[model samples]
Target: MITDRLSLGLQLLRIIVAFMVGGYAINECTQGFSSEKWPTVKGKVTSSTIKEVFTRSGTSHHEADIHYQYVVDGKTFKADRIIFGGANFRSPKELIEKFKADKPVEVHYKPGEPSVACLETGVNFTVLIPLVAFGGILAFMAFADMSKSMQPNSSIGPRPASNSSGLAQPKMQQVKGIILFTGLVAAIFGFKYGINAIHFGAIPGNAIAIVVLVGGGFLFVTFISLLPAAAGMLARARRFDLAEKVAKLNTKIASTMSAHSYETAVAYGLQAEIAQEQMKYPQALELSKKALNVLACRPKVDLAVNKFDDSTNRMIKESTIRYEKHYNDTESLCNESYGSILFDMGMYGDALTHAEKAKRLAQDNLRNAAAPDQAGTKRALAGALALRGKIELAIGSPENAKSDLQESIRLRKEIPHQFEEYLAASMADLASAYCVQSEFRMAERTIEEGLKIVEGSNKPSHRLAKAKLRAQLADVKMGMGQLSNAESLLMESLDVREELLPAGHPEIAKTYLSMAKLRDLQGKQRDAIGYRRSAGEMLTNCFGPQYQAV
Candidate 1:
């Protein structure tokens, strides 16, 4: 069919044209492709000379342009958005070795203007690579199309007209077109509605509003898109191995970026997490790395903002290393605050170490602080020590854990005005320690007492305490062979969790396991087996297969 050949040729031409247009757009947005400025700068070549030069206050020889001195290029210039890398060089020798001497050095300047001297040449290609890649890809696609067009048509067999199906073909085409058009409309509507929803809520792009907006968007989109993607994923998830599809999806996501760097990373990371939760581990990992890279490229902020991000990233990506390493460069109080975040991430060793270090740092900083700052220092120290205690418990070092927890509780109690709800974890750990010691009565009593103190005292709403108490009570009753009592308590906990958590939460799995035991006691063999299987699946999903109960 002449129509078929023409259609194929048109499709190829469209693709080639689109790529060229996209490449041009990307190049223009990124600045002239060949002259894209390097983000990094270098000063005099030195092996050891580390110093921070803010964009605003670099020692400038010329009043008009911003000039800074570095070991690589003793007197270098700066462009816009200068930042400090983790490495701090103290000597020229160190700088030389760390950064190869022969490396091209470029200086960046602010106030993007023609001939404003914004970027220096010979710097890292972070800014240049993309501009070149997009252009090159477009050029390559154009050449490939020309080659295909020149190929002999003898090898391209035209499909013979289907005489029997000819009458049905138009209907099939209509159906396909309708379905595709509907999906396209749905996707566009979803995007517009999603954006509007966030706007109506006045979600802050940089403030706490971001969290609410992102969380709400995730919930909403998941609620809407889940059924379709899931159905599609499931049908093929089993019929066809998802390895190739997942890989392609991952590659697509990794290459895509939003307007903002950090936002892009967060999006990728969250998408990865969503994929992972849906049993798509490969896609999850791929998206997660893309998210991380996006975050890495984000602009640097103030100390408090940076610390907040460190803790937040830990929760989002489930790693404390970012918090710990970054904390060392931050204020002592912020570092101490980050310790508790590390504890929450279950990085017990790092948590303990960082907490103690933070405590010592805070105490030292406090002694050095003026009288006006003493209160803040003491508050920080209490938080640090309290977090240290919780970390101790997580590692199963009860004696030390107890000591730390008790000290933290005492300090927190002493500072009623500060309202340190995070310290409540110390109490939770203490009760857990009591449970481990087989002091059920003592454990129950302690949780009750602590619950009272935390009930309305701004200590996480006492819900956490209630959950822990329920879990412990269930276990205790089960141990005592009070199957019915245990079952009731477990069910209550499960109900509470079901109300509070998502479908596959780890706590839900734990509750299922407890219920499985009760089911076994009642001789509900099928039910027990199903419950165990579910619990196993959830545990595997949350903590992977290596996690064993203590």
Candidate 2:
């Protein structure tokens, strides 16, 4: 009887809160800012009354007991719960009078459960269930993972999920991320509660609640003081949330993992790639070099494995080849990415040096490639060749560019299974080589093929490649004196590039330069100068003051 009575009290509380929310305000809250997308339907109130349920202690709970019916597919369902006040009524008495008889009302039904209806829709009580469900699943998985990692190992085997220094590794970082996430959510709720308590001016009476809240906030701060937000990094890193990417990567490096692990090296390499894309050349060079430094993991890996039993050592030794190949592949890709950064910095000598290193290392690693991992080695090799070709073109060696780009295209074509975007990229570079040598017709054909490849592939990165191909096609059209076609292609290329790239990215400047060329051809000399000046400023900002615009 007490359980049933308490349930009635809770339902009365819900009704009282909804009634207090005010007329039409609930409608705005439901439709304007509702997190859930609810479909609306027409309904009418059949009955309305105010009722009081008394407890054994003679305490009474007053609520508006209103029943409404809505139809779906010729079937009708009734609900007595009032989500909020309706019909321009400001008070419960007004609601009772307004809803005494049949009155049309708007109803919002749960998408999958049409029987479940509400007078007004907004973030309801069920929202926390999703958060708790997600957090509980992650917490359980993380706990289970830690249990496995906690298994006893030989004295020589540093903990499997951490480094020798006992700090969390990348794998364990995620495995422990739930604690931080839960603490963050707890802290937010606690802070909100404390604020409400103070607003209500319930001192001493709400003092215990405030203390519990303070403790929760402290735990949250302790976890977050470990990072700007540890949970946010785990959440947004894979989503490619650009605003938080570098900051999260920086936090990932600083907080949990050792600076020298292979995973940490990958993080550094990723930051370097981002820096290069943002046109921060000096920082990108430093970051890529740091990635290479951290990737020198051979001695540490070998030493750790040597401490095991002979049979175990031998088995681990057999797997060392895989580690070595991964190391080489990462190094080659980083070198190629660094070379491109240098090429943009106008450090042609240094750019060509690293470009050759990337190409040589990629070629050397190919001997270890078998069918299982052959695609990765070939991808690194093709990427190296493509970067070298671009660098060679910048150095005024068209022949070398042509040779390298052709090899990149040929090698990439063999891996067509998952490499359409890459093949298209290499073909676009080859088209540039042809244009540099005044072979405009060949350039047009190569670039058109590149565009066709991108259009057919449907890869997420296809639009980026298509933009480059269109830009190349524009240059070829200009060379062929098809000014109108050239202008059209430039506009298309510029639109895509501007949409996809950061404001200071090199490709955007290149598109601006093409625009300048088009304006010059059209005899709009002043507009040409304006475009040229804008392109020059952007390139200068990207590559620093040392860079000279073509």
Top candidate when judged by lDDT against the true structure: 2
Give residue 545's lDDT in candidate 1 (0 to 100): 67
Kindly list the per-residue Cα lDDT of model 2 for residues 1-550, writing each as its tens digit.
0011112223333233223221122232332233135677889999888777697779987656678999987789887545422222235676677666498888776555666566754433343334344434444444444443443421122234334332233345565655655664564355333432221111221543564466445434334332322322322222234523644545375435566655555556666665665566788799888877876643445446868899998777667766777777777877887787788777878878888888887787788553236667777888889888988887789899999999988777665233356677778888988998999888988887776565533233567788889988998888888999999988988887787677867888888888888888889989899988898888887766668833
Give all TM-scores, in the order shown: 0.37, 0.54
Please give me the total number of clashing residue pairs in predicted model 2: 0
For model 2, the stretches where C-alpha displacement exceeds 4 angstroms are 1-255, 297-316, 369-372, 416-419, 456-460
Compared with the true structure, model 2 gives a TM-score of 0.54
- Candidate 1, 345-456: lDDT as tens digits: 3446755776777688666655652223344455666667767766776677777866766776666555423322244445556766666667667666655555444343
Alpha-carbon shift of residue 197 in model 1 (angstroms): 52
